[model samples]
Target: MSVKENCQKIEERILKACQRSGRKREEVVLLAASKTQPVEKILQAYYCGIRYFGENRVQEGIEKIEALKDYKDIHWHLIGGLQTNKVKYAVKYFEMIHSIDREELVDEIEKRASKMNKIQEGLIEVNFGEESKYGVKEENLKKLFEYILTKEHIKILGLMAIPPYFENPEDVRPFFRKLRQLKEDLEKDFNVKLPHLSMGMSHDFEVAIEEGATIVRIGTALFGERI
Candidate 1:
């Protein structure tokens, strides 16, 4: 199917998921994970009414952002594991970073954003103690939040996670539930409101939305498999 057709189908699914979950369609943001896809494909999604796009790499995202600079309403997101060296470019280009899991990263972002004279928005990536995944452990999340609360240039909007894959999407529900619960706990503990839960992807986005995902990062289901 074409990108437009894929977008239509995904939109329908998002609407139905919202209905099933008794949530408003406007509440969920459909972020096109335009990692390796070319600008043409992103434009196709843009024409289909998608305004949010996520890139996994800082350099690639910078190129795409430059190429698509004329599209003023587009919101770019960095959704991969960000390195300290790349913090400057990532802060300058992307509107939000979705993989903040350490103090070093927070410090770098705060410094860069402060130099650029802008507040950088980000999400705290929570790893379920998976050695392979990149995120702060659940036990260490409070500590991370405490440190981030002292920073001036970067703001934590919510949480993001790449949960363990399950053939059946139902099995992933618990992980999503855990992320949401963590967000709730953080809000109460810090007396702050973290509004965005950047979880779920092509395979289990509907499940993510049902569990209070304000931002769903979808790629293959929208842009087809990467080449």
Candidate 2:
């Protein structure tokens, strides 16, 4: 599908999901996951009014950032695994690091940010279900959050989760719902402001939005399957 067509279809899904959940369509944010996609496709997305772009690798995202940083005000999100050694490039280029859950890595990011004199915007990746790709385990999230908050060079904006994907998108609702509730519980019980829920993907974003996902990472739905 063309960029315009993908954008239209995604918008329809967002709107339909919002309506289904009794929320406004404008409230949900669509982040086009552009891993392996070229700058030209991103330009196409920009033409279709996509402002947020997500990349899954630091090296690949840096390439895209260099190619199109001047072309648009695109917010680059690091949606893949982030290592401590690569914190320098990540801190310099990414607007948000979406997979941050380990305390040791968080320390490294803070140290690197301190050296660079920058406070990086980052999210706490949580293992919301049986799928354990790259997030901190559920029980350790609170302690990790408390420890990271003490660091001046790193700010915890919200949470990110990759709920286990089922062949049927409807089966994905429970995970999204759990993530939303987890954020709410963390805020109320822990007395912290976590307004963002960075969950959902191409196949099940509508379910994510219905469960209150502010940022949806979608790639295949926008740019087709990755090579």
Candidate 3:
């Protein structure tokens, strides 16, 4: 199927998931994970109504962002692990950063945003599923949150996570549920409403949406498997 057709199918599935969970389709955001995808194909998805795109690498993402500069209203997101050295470019190129996992990275982001006079928005990535992953552990979230609040230039929009891969998407449901509950708990503790839950990928996005994911990251499902 073409990118447009793929997008239509994904949208239908997302709507179905939202309906099953008693949620409105508008409450959910579809972010096309465009890492390693060509500019032409990305444009195809763009024309098909995908305004939000995510990339994994800083350099590659910046390149695409530069190439697509003429495409107004395209919101670029950094969804993979970000390095401290790339914080400046990330703040300059992308509108949102989704992989903030540590205090040091947050500091870097704050410094760069301060220099640019821009308010940087990001999601706190929770590393609950794997030991070797790149997110802040669930237990340490509050400490991180508190520290982040002091950084006037950076705003923690919500939480994001990449659960362990399971052949059956059902197995990933627990991870999504936990992230949602964590969000609820954190909101109550901090008295702040997190508007975005950046979880789920192409394989298990429907389940993620069913469990309260406001933004679902989809790549292969929209752009086909990466070469």
Tens-digit lDDT track for model 3 on 1-227?
89999999999999999999999999999999998999999999999989999999999999999999999899999998999998999999989999998999999999999999999999999998588889999999999999999999998899999999999999999999999998899899999999999988999999999999999999999999896
Please identify which of the two predictions, 1 or 3, would achieve the higher TM-score against the true structure. 1
- How well does candidate 1 score on lDDT at residue 219? 99
State the displacement of the C-alpha of residue 72, model 3, in Å, after optimal TM-score superposition: 1.3
Residues 159-198 of candidate 2: C-alpha lDDT, one tens digit per residue: 9999786999889888888777777878887798887899
lDDT of each: 0.96, 0.87, 0.94
Best by lDDT: 1
> Model 3 misses residue 227 by how many Å?
2.1
Ranking by TM-score: 1, 3, 2
TM-score comparison, 2 vs 3, better candidate: 3
Report residue 84 deviation for candidate 2 (angstroms).
1.3
- Residue pairs in steric clash, candidate 3? none
Poorest lDDT segment (10 consecutive residues) of candidate 3: 128-137
Q: How far does residue 170 in candidate 3 sit from its true spot (Å)?
A: 0.9
**Clash list (residue pairs), candidate 2:** none
Stretches > 4 Å off in candidate 1: none
Best-to-worst order by lDDT is: 1, 3, 2
lDDT of 3: 0.94
Candidate 1 residue-wise lDDT, 157-201, digit = tens? 999999999999999999999999999999998899999999999
So what's the TM-score on candidate 1? 0.99
